[model samples]
Target: MHIKEGGITSPRIEPRFEQLESSLKPQIAPADASWKRATLTRQPRFNNVVARNWRGELPLWVSYWVIGFIGNLLIGIIPVAVDGTLSGHGYDPRILLITLAGGWLAIAAVSVWQGVGVWRSADARIIARKDLGRAAPWAILAKLAVFVGLVRLIALAVNIGAPQMTELSRMAFFDDPDISPYALRIMRNGTELEISGGFKFGLNEDLVRLLRAAPKVRIVHLDSTGGRIGEAVTVYNTIQERKLITYVSHQCMSACTVAFVGGQQRWLYSRAQLGFHAPTFPGISAGELADATEEQREIFSAVGIDRSFVDKALSTPNNSIWLPPEDELLRSRVITNVSDGSNFAASGFGANLPRDTLAAQLKKSLAALSDLERVAPDEFNSLVDDFLEGYQKGQTEAHLLAQGRQRFLRIISTNLPLADDPTLIDFGKLMIDQYTFLNQRDPSLCYQYAAKGELDPFLLSPTLREREAALDQRVLQTAAKRPTIPAQILQSLWGKVISAVTLRVGRDNAHMILGTKVSPAQYGSYCEATIAFYQEIIRLREPEAAELMRQVLAPK
Candidate 1:
């Protein structure tokens, strides 16, 4: 099969097949083999490098999916659920919402950083460059969209589970009976102790301990809806003993009011509220109720509170709280100061009135009363004895007299008869004057004054006085037939007269008496003299005759 081009015959045509077969087999050069070997060596190593790079970024990708999406979703949902569950349990929802928003932002920021890091990696950049025309923008956006959608789905799941989660958490955390609702703090450098929440049994002990630990603590800031009458009473006694100040910046209600009244100096913020209601002993027997009523009356009475305030508190049903008006609070002396968290000391009652100044003022008041000589000798003497006793006990004469006057008025008012007759009004005025003289010759009692059509002894006309005398005879005659009438009905009628007289005297001469320049001891003596005079007059008149005279003063 070999053809010779020259004249020489080809050597061995039979063996040409071998040479042809050899030529047909492929032949490799050294350079070409070297190039193939080099390519094979580089390809696998390049793949390995790419795989390592991806592995390095795997954690970031995992984080984006788990923490960014799932974790964030849970964070947002947890608070929402918790807040929902605690809706009425005193948690603020806005706090939860803020927490959720913060969590989401933190997660989103981390996810974006990680995703960008992956996109900027060497392998990723190479791939992106190669796919620039085919899948650059849309593919990246689609991936991001998928991630975002997953995150949204997680959020949706959280929302769906929120209600149930909230309920579960609430039951777990809030409904536990062992947890106390009260919060106590020693604040303002331990000069103030704040008590918040319901008054529990241990509160009194806690307060005592706090007071002992920080003897400098002069202020007890009360914010309570009130609780346990017995505990409140204990607190009140402690406060009174320590002569501590009580302050209400928010709410003081029910038994809390009792504590507030016990303060040596009581203060209330403009926005603060003091609520009162009749004492309640749920499921108690009638006997218990009666006892409770008496106890409450005694508490207010001890504080020099008027019958009106007591009546208002007692009339309010247990379930309802009576929030007295600011004016009422001021007038009742329940809150001696209304402050705005500044200058409390300066604004407080008697804060500006030095003891010496008060004593001087009281003396002047007594001197004026002594000049009148209107009170009976015996009553005046008794008043003097009481004043001296109080003074010896380190109580200021003015304070003693004020307390006595307030107590006397309260007693008379509580027992006063409800009558519309002018003669009764006149008689009431005379009785009030006599009582005022007996307590402390408040010169105001000598002045004529009546409110709401009631008789004011100080303001009574001679004709009215005569008529009152006539009514007294009639009352005595009636009382002879029914002895109980003198103690119950006639006594009340006499009490009304006493109340009217004292109210007028106090109203007209309060400033004069309280701010007088006389010495306290002298003022006390005058008060005693006036009281003694009134006492003698009553003794001379006899109870039935006095009561009869009171009735005679009532208008027909």
Candidate 2:
């Protein structure tokens, strides 16, 4: 089998055309038949119009449009053919096109079906299933074709079908227990979660169902204008698992308010309202129980808030809790954003005001209120009486009130085993109450007049006046940071009033003392707090004397 120089080594060659010619010997050709040329074409695996388009046969879209248009043309011509008339826009163009294409495809499909039927019926040529080799390649090819057709389907029906399924999921905040619809997907953005429909029964169950269905969902509570306490608690439990954020777009009252406070992120709107009173069950009664007892910090942490933010929220009540502007909410981690609404900012009348502003205003107003309580004796007493009346109602009116004032008093009286550190003033709350009653009855008695030297009339060991004076004295001592002479001069007195410093009394009378200083805002800054007097003598910080202040303020 080795090839030498020019010798030809050949393999066998046979004429394969003769075998097919021998097999078709019975078929006769007509004398006039010109030998027809035959060619093999590769029919595409995917034949449907949309399917072909999906397989990169994008021209089919134009074809579909054209065919639909032609179909519409046919429909439009129908009236002309039948009654010599034309159709207008009233005719559905889409339906006409689909109908026409469908009819054409149906006819073509029938022709192919009949030919296949004739081939299968030929007795001698009927191929056995096994002989066709366990389902032809064409069968697998058909499955692939069907898949392509399904994915590439462009009919209005298929497009229309999808949105109907998605509509249910779009409403994540909405709850409806009456019907078992799909749950929505959501997250805790600084975004608002608004619920459209009003409240209905079984809302708690609906919310529970939602959480169970989508455990990973982040939380957002929009304007929940109060709701069932029991239901709110259940919803809160669901939210606590992830420490989900809860928001009150404006007002979250009663049960909902409790839930908001429990949130990892607490929020308030500029226009938001927070109503008091305990959380309650709807249509059911329970023993009188307080709403929330633990400190604000613990509640926030238990619900997943980072601890640092809880500190700020609790510390600044009106700022972070009540009238917290949106910016502070973000800084304090109470809320992430305003989402969409009038931002949380203070306004005139001061109802919806910023925290710092509120604090300053409160200090001024309270100072005034305290003075009015002393000066216009009757008017001041009535004002205090009004405060006490409101305080009493707020603490006792509702069965489920937090009752801070009462609880504080109880702790002071040692009637309550818990709450070791009650506010210091609780010991004389009764005395204050008596004063309130007297003021309400008479309205014009000065506090000293009301006391009328009976300050300790009960034969108590220490006289009431003596006790009051002792407390007042202690207060004054605490209020003074340094002795009247000034801290720098405390050790050098040598038992004598110095001649270098004159001990002269000011015009504020020999009794009263005052301090004054330059403005804080100007370049030459100072304030009244820097100057003071002690023991009827005018005393001032040497460095900030009148001449020095004049120089600091001069044309600065």
Candidate 3:
């Protein structure tokens, strides 16, 4: 119906019901019209734009999640785990950790960059609403991955900042074989157990048994170049458990240091040294080596060594060693105190060995005997055999030394060429008589002569010639006037003879014979007095000494 207007005679205007009705009815478009709309005339769908952008970015997303993050993580963690699991070993590959840390930073940058790109380009809400129905789980996974990546970054920080912590954690998973002990020279003196030699397999058990049998043992003396780490550990445990002191009078190296640190009180004599180096197992992987090295590193650390020092020690190659100065060792807490081992007796064969065994032992132990053996093997062997016989028949070291001296002097006499000349014979006889007389007073003087090479035939031969020529001149002159000569004349003649005999023998030798040091200023007068006394004895005892006197003073 139309509303009435003010103008009369106007046709009744009504609302156009037909146009409204037709507009409301569904209108079908031409097929070509729809095709034209889709292909050429349509505005862009914002949701579809997002889906396309995301599809284009799929490669980077795959790289970030699959290759960069997950791949790198597996590369770092899997080997450590697998090696530790399969071989019961672990190691810190510093180079590998550094490389992985670099990769983590790179991947983290890519992840952030790619995320901002997606945020700026794609409408994630629209994309999910339209097409992500089946991929809803992937969206949740992305959130979880972000959280995991954050956790990994934190761990990487810990690895870089506190490497020792990481190393300790890695070491905890391994259960390595214990180092077995090797045989060594072990000696017991009172309450001390002295161990000397390389530590090898079987030492632990041996030491354990020794300690068991000797519970009163209070000190463990170690002289070693190291050996089995396990054996050292055994000693360390024993020392710690017993609350015993550890002493080093000579040298303790490598694994020996491990045992030494276990002592409640560690001792290193002034001349002694402690050596250290990284632990090694033959044919082990680098990772395993690091694990083994960590064992000692932790041990040293527990004993209050500086971390840097331990690191350097463990980093050193096993083929070489680190012998820290005694002062440095004390500063580093490697030892508790400086000791000279004065309160303790030095290690030696304290057992009462059989005669033959003692002789062999002395032969090997004495430098003088070794020298004699080198110079005269047969004489040395015969002397040693005689020593054995005498010792079996009860002879002391001093007595044996005396007998050896006598035999040595006899050897020099037998080898001398004195029999061809009467003058040479007399000179030789004089030396023998002098030695025999002095030896009756102090047998050690004979040993001193042998030791000092004072009776060396080669050295004495020229001197004897000089003495012989002097004696020949004096004896001829004395023989011309002696038998009926005045007392002063006889005394003067004998003085000249004695001077020739004692001249090359020297005042030092004369004092040595007397076993006292006469002053240099008084040496000449003292020597003359000694010579005069011996001369009178010779003159009174033997007419053979005065045969020249008898033969020449007679008138035919």
Q: Is candidate 2 or candidate 3 better by lDDT?
A: 3
Question: Where in model 1 is the C-alpha error above 4 Å?
Answer: 1-180, 344-556
- In model 3, residue pairs whose N, Cα or C atoms come closer than 3 Å (at least 3 residues apart or on different chains), thus clashing, are 180-201, 181-200, 181-201, 181-202, 181-203, 182-200, 182-201, 182-203
lDDT string for model 3 (1-556, tens) is 0101101111122211111122333466445767877776554454343344333343333423433344345445543443344333212333323433344454445444434333332334225434523333343344444455556545544544245334423333321223222333334334777777666545666777888887778887787778667557767777788898887877888988888898888888766788888886432445556667877887888878888878877787889999989888888788888854344534322223355665567666444455455556788788777866653343333455467667754543342322223433364356555444445444444344422434422233455545533543333322222234466756666556555545646645545434465444543444344544345434542443443233222333
Task: Assess each prediction's global lDDT (C-alpha) against the native.
Answer: 0.52, 0.34, 0.53
For candidate 2, the TM-score is 0.22
**Model 3 regions more than 4 Å off:** 1-181, 184-190, 196-202, 249-251, 268-273, 282-295, 304-315, 323-367, 374-556
Compute each candidate's TM-score over C-alphas. Answer: 0.31, 0.22, 0.37
Best by TM-score: 3
How much is 392 displaced in model 1, in angstroms?
Answer: 44
Span of ten consecutive residues with least summed lDDT in model 1: 1-10
